[model samples]
Target: MRPREASALDALPALPRDDDGPVFAEPWQASAFAMTLALSERGVFSWAEWVDTFSGELKRAAEAGTPDDGSRYYHHWLAALERLIAEKGLADPAILVDARDAWDRAAKATPHGKPIGLSPDDLARIRDAG
Candidate 1:
């Protein structure tokens, strides 16, 4: 993943899962979906355009013989997000740098050695803070 895209993922909170369920649950996907929504709301790209680009990327990847694996799907999503940011020149490298630094600081500061994972509520707070 690109540095900024990785930073964005790192900024998100961990997804809670049910005890008797698959590892990936609604919460995890929702976290990713929320990131997409937040980025769109910030004018990085329109929702329709973002969906189109990501869908196209997935199709291209499948055509290129990459299996439809979970990792590959997430990678494609990250790549698409990176491309969108680059195409619009919406998120500055400096801004990403700051985010990266803040993420590092937050990770270090979190209690119980938990990485800085934001809940949906936390995301809302961050959005409002900005």
Candidate 2:
């Protein structure tokens, strides 16, 4: 992590973490955190904006009766990232949906215990959409 970005992340209040820093129950949770950090480093949005949007997502989810046991934390993280990127006109919600579908197809096509790789058709659909 860049020094500046690391410090900015350190400043976030109420982050779910231990002494080792952010605790993720799944690999995708780690990925979501890293992706959000990368986007923020690239100036997609400020940390302040991220905090606000993420808090809103958590708040809304709580109000909607989602679990508070941290199982759904990264779900809200991904949702917030998508909303922020779309709000900034940096990404299209539909294209994101298409990419997600493509990923699902790729995962379904992969054999058990093998790395998931996108098929040519999946790649084509993604590139075409972009």
- lDDT by residue (tens digit), candidate 2, 1-130: 6565466767755645446555787798899999999999998899999999999999999899886666687999999988898899986778788778878887988888999887888678768866
TM-score of 2: 0.75
Q: What is the TM-score (0 to 1) of candidate 1?
A: 0.49
**Tens digit of per-residue lDDT, candidate 1, span 1-130:** 5565456778865664445655444555656667888988987678999989899889989898886655456678877776777777866656566566666666766897565764555456445544
Pairs of colliding residues, candidate 1: 13-117, 13-118
TM-score of each model, paired residue for residue: 0.49, 0.75
Cα error, candidate 1, residue 2 (Å): 53
Where model 2 places Cα greater than 4 Å from the true spot, the runs are 1-22
Top lDDT prediction, candidate number: 2
